[model samples]
Target chain A: MFFRVVLGMVLAVASCGAMAALQIEITGGINQGQAIAVLPFEQPAEVKVDVAAVVDADLMRSGKFSPLPRSGMPTGMAKDEELLKADAEVAVTGRVYKEGGAYQVEYRIVALKGADRGKLLGHFKGAAPLDLMRQAAHRVSDRVYETLTGQKGCFRTRIAYILRRDGAPFPYQLMTADYDGYNETAVLKSTQPLMTPSWSPDGRRLVYVSFEGRRPAIFVHDIFTRQRTRLASYPGLNSSPSWSPDGSKIAMTLSKDGQPDIYYYDLGSKQLVRVTQNQAIDTEPTWSADSRSLYFTSERGGKAQIYRHDFATGKNERVTYQGKMNLSARSIPGSNAIIVITQQNGYRVARMDVDGSIYMLTTSSLDESPSVAPNGSMVIYATVYNGRKGLAIVSADGRFKANLPSSSGEISSPTWGPALDK
Target chain B: MMLMAVAAAMSIAGCSTTSGSGAGAEGYDGQGVVTGIDSDGAMTVGDPNEVQTYNGPESLREKNTIYFNFDSDQILDAYVGTMQSHAQFLRNNPDAKIVIEGHTDERGTPEYNIALGERRARSVARYMQNLGVDVGQLSIVSYGEEKPADPTHSEAAWSKNRRAVINY
Candidate 1:
């Protein structure tokens, strides 16, 4: 009942800022999701970030929970009876307060009905500077989501993407932001183009393709230190740099030898090992969870398709045969499924199981560059929105969908970073 | 006089546009001269026997960019004369270095588009090499769909975007 009403008000109010942050627009979700109430956190006028709203949006984006609107929420700290009356299965209440020139946020997830009625499921408190209030709020969401869903929440994780602002001094920017599209910071800016950013497993650095000198070169950039090391600047096209799961090597597509083929650069030894020997276009190499094999898109099969290259056996096998073209395959964490851009009706994001069954996730025609969340619960991709390119998110089940439209220029090649250490 | 007559006949044959496949040596009329305007009304003609010297970008008649079909990297027959003109210019002036920049329409994955763009550029570079352009004069880069000649999302714009630009 709450979700039915909330569906009418799906678009969240856009927050005002100097740099317009990505506004979350929930398009669809499953109707059977657990109904939860996230009350507005009690905070002083000086504190700007809404901790409860962030948590609510995070849960809603997960597609496992339907957050009740504030209109349905009872006034002033709803009790268990009030929550039950509002059809909320669970209630998240929180407060943000200042302490010693810093901001601290405290939140509690309370069960409303069932055997665990009136029981506190989770209580989390985090502190950060005023500027990092959104991050602190995301941590609260992470804890609350994990406690409720029994799975690690990706709210605390960040997303790395390329934002191209035409005519700017540095048109292309490597950006990092909270999963909710807040706290966007440019990690690297370039006059030429930057694309295909792959996050290191440690979430501290990013390996991406930058055309800084009017040529495609792979660079490993430390997100915090702002130090850049050119990994591959081979003669021809050098692009599609994917960090291995173990963080020891980076698999990329290089044309120095001949056509674009998969090659892994060992960070420790600085040796480039060829993965696929095909003359066809072999690119977009994504390491498996174990880092023992690579899942890459190759045209060796006559058309672009997903292929698994086992490093130990030196064997290559085609993984996808259903789509007209399947490109940019990324292994989903904790599962045998991989998210990729498949061309069926048009280029759309889809999840392919180990058995080779394809499940379309997004309905957009021009969707590309699908990056699965660390938890594999959602996918972020680049798509055309109203003729302008922007990023979007969809639940792995294709139930929930949200559009993250930037305030200005186009955004593409989004890669969700790994979960940060607690 | 015999070589000039043969070159003029080849340029006349290149103007036929009947061969839709990859153009062979007959498709290219060398000597930095592009004769006979194509259907696009975008070609320039110079004396086939003049032994045209490479002056600058103006010498190539501004025919540096070549487009491809959807999801294709094959050099169209229409662009063969343009490639021949560029090849002649590069061979005449080995000191002139050019960057063959590849691109694609805003479809498919960005990484794949990068590969496709490179394929387009490589196709152009190979075409020039076949026409005897020095390898040292050509370097290739792919912008994929990032730098579009036209940013519009329609088929016309994508045709313009799916191109390989010869930047001298």
Candidate 2:
């Protein structure tokens, strides 16, 4: 079932690019997207990949832009008259040139209003080899997105996920890749189950559960150094390690006290601070943007629902009422709303404001592990497609939805890494 | 009936699939695959692929596993005899040490499932202790939603997955 779908999508993606990046199948989006034109980038023969097309696709897939086809674009440069005729409101023209064996790309965006020659809105420049076409294109796309939307773009961020293959030596493999699922590299492989990967604030380390010791144990792994340090493995379960906002502590669920409850592991002191003393299950801890409160899933109210615990007051209150069961609530960076996997029509992902306004984001029956991008533009979650677990992405507003399916095995605990600054 | 109501309540919330019970695989009884022989005369039960020996008592394998309802850890009345027999086997073998692995169907959050699975295993351990089984002979671990008896998403598969198996 998995391979058949992959083959079908591969044939459909043959038109997109040479290598098969994440074959995104957008299920839902706005009817009338914004009009933008990305002109063909002038590049030397050394640059094999098309940078302009990548930028165009990124904008188009965002469910925000309807990029005009290159054939319909003007001959040399789009004038206001030509763009207006083509129904394009904005235009992106760029050139990729080599200098001293390194490549340099510069883009100029024009706002085509009423005038004959459109006024240049902004100029963005990037330097990399022709081999780094994807990164260059992402840079251009980020600039274009910021200029149009007045918000930071997360095109350069990385996402870490777990791939579990049944017969593979390392059945559970931790992998990291670009936000679009390209350039995926396996960071660690283990014979035991690996899950709940949470990225540190700096994006250099990930703390997750590795069952290598014949039991659940939390391990903090540095991405670049390939070094791992055991964080928590006290008597029972040492799972659900979520990094705090300041990277000083990790809030996790431990059953060392005979029942699973929330605890914070201070990185400096290496001491566990008990957060919740309730008899009910208190797990899946995520810190607020300010790090003053934690939003976690609890069964204290009979069934699973999201709850907020303020550290200063030592008071926790149930936050979600619409869903009978709500779990895996992740705070959107710099936002008041949290993206949670709520029980609606079979565990769909939804964004809920602190005031309790809910906006459903997915159409799948089984969706879990929602991680928002650093810019709070998109939420990536794991969903069951054809009974095989895979990752699906939805825009923050629930307008755009796309599937990021792997070739094989189940995908889980997708942690969107911090934004890589330019 | 209360367990069924709770399972139904879980389904009505649009949370997950139907709740089920009992093993659904063909030729696979409650007897788990024999992973290896123990220091004692008992055998270690684990994944079928890791099964090394078939020389152990078939009755021990058959009575070692107890299934549960979805999201509920209540051991069914049908498994009472099995649990009693296992408790007797432990009492008869003083040197035997058994690891009770708790598991859950892939319906809820992984963290919660771990807690739920642990509760189920603890319930079993407590039950055996009441039946005069030595508490020192029993060790508990939970695979949560990690290891599934049946990987499919249907209720039949889930019913089998939500279980606690005693491995020597």
**lDDT tens digits by residue: candidate 2, A1-422:** 01111212232222221113456665666334678878888788777767887787677656677677676554334455654555578888878887887888887888875673478788877688766787888988988999998888778888898877665434566778787777666676554677889999899999998765567888887877755677888888788899987888899999888678899989899788999888888888998877788988888889989999998899998899987788888888878889988777687899998789888877777787888888887888888876788888888877667787766668887888887786
Residue range A1-422, candidate 1, lDDT tens digits: 12212333222324421125455666777455788888888787866776677777888888888788776454434565665665688888877777897777777788888898889887777787777777777787778778888889888888988887654434566778777677566665554678889998998989988765557778787877655677888888798899998999999988888888899999899899888777799988999889999999999879899999998898998899997988888888889999888998889999998888999987789998888898989899989887878889988878788888776778888889999877
Flag regions of model 1 displaced more than 4 Å.
A1-21, A97-104, A125-129, B1-55
RMSD of each: 12.4, 10.2
- The local distance difference test score of model 2 is 0.75
DockQ: which candidate is best? 1
Error of 2 at A178 (Å): 0.8
* CAPRI quality band, candidate 1: incorrect
Residue range B111-134, candidate 2, lDDT tens digits: 778888898999999999999998
State TM-scores per candidate: 0.85, 0.85
Question: Which sections of candidate 2 miss by over 4 Å?
Answer: A1-21, A30-33, A61-63, A68-71, A74-81, A113-117, B1-57
Q: lDDT score of model 1? A: 0.77
Top-lDDT candidate index: 1
Candidate 1: residue pairs that collide: none
What is candidate 2's CA lDDT for residue A278? 82
lDDT of each: 0.77, 0.75
